[model samples]
Target: MIKKVLSFAVIGVSTVTLAIGLSPNTASAALGDQPEVFHSSYNPGKSTVTISTSNTEKKPVKASGYLSKYFKGYAHKAKNGKWQFHLDGYGDAEGLYNNVRNDQTVRVYLSEGKEQGAFDVKVKTIVKKNKVKKKKAIKISKAINGKNVKIKNNKRKSDVITIKKVSKNDKITIYNAKGKRLVQKTAKGNTIKIYVRQLGKKAGAVNVSTQKKGYKESGKIKVKYGRE
Candidate 1:
């Protein structure tokens, strides 16, 4: 009877060893010889691409082809365990649409040990159109017409011009008679002040203009300056 019990215990040990050998961990160790696997996703209307590795290791990857060609920086893994790449530019939506079509492929390169592997990821559908904010037209205050303004020869002093109907995004520019930019500032409120000074002893005319996106440029306004 003791011999029979010993035989059963030996068989149980052997069965457990066999099961451990067939576990997923053992199979994944052999993945170094297998092909690299990756999954890719993209955000609509944004220039972000996320790539995840099937294997949980933090391996570096290089992205190429399609919109990836215009990426400004190298791809890096984020805290969320996914690799992120960005397509950088002011007109991201238009540029992305022109560079990549529907169902395009992006090449991803990876290094496994001393060997290198590559795979292609199909691009996801992205919204081609991005909403753009319309710019507001800049309006000048009638209080300060571009005519017969007083100026001081003192470089330390400046003449302040009040502007009206200003947007936060509007930029105010002051130009001399020679078309040289003297001062440029962004508007912070409905009114902004433009300071003008005489760089030389002689009095001259200064032009003021307002600039913003999507809005017609405020034409140059001529203001006469004389020694105070």
Candidate 2:
């Protein structure tokens, strides 16, 4: 059987980050006194909608803007070829944008697909917030006291040994050379124990892995049978 010992540290963080820009001031706006005609705003950052020309069918329009400072990261994408919107700081599925919108303006250019006359324009902006959580400072350790295993065959019975460490809430896994798991156990206390069949002649090397809530550690142990 294979056994392992390890230690680890746990750390975590909490925060919020939103990618959708749905706010009140960032709402969509129109350049004219039209109702059904308008533009779209970017994601969670500064929501702004600008409309130019109240053509019943505005041939589709696009708008782009930056995200808030509190946001960890932000990204946006549109439907099909409807409207081609490009924000400075916003990134596309292909890659990051060429420019960044850090105090930059929400530059939105529009053009008609069919109509060719004067068009009314409208613009609006909205703002929102988000939260996020993360884990940090996770560590793992595995140290074998000896390079050999001890075995005692009283009547060819199984040898129950307890492998422990100074870590709590740790996960332990044991595997053989062929990647076959013999016994997998979790650490409730700082240490854990296991029982392996003591074959007087079946003694060799095995891999052991231990992991905590946020940290991961691994080590190896040599099992020796027929020891007084």
Top candidate on lDDT is 1
Number of backbone collisions per candidate, in order?
0, 24
Write candidate 1's Cα lDDT for 75-176 as tens digits.
Answer: 334799645443222222223311233355554433332323443445433332436989876654322344333344455576665666667877877788
TM-score of 1: 0.31
Best by TM-score: 2
TM-score of each: 0.31, 0.35
Candidate 2 at 30: error in angstroms? 33
Candidate 2 regions exceeding 4 Å error are 1-155, 214-228
Off by over 4 Å in 1: 1-155
In candidate 1, where is summed lDDT lowest over 10 consecutive residues?
A: 89-98
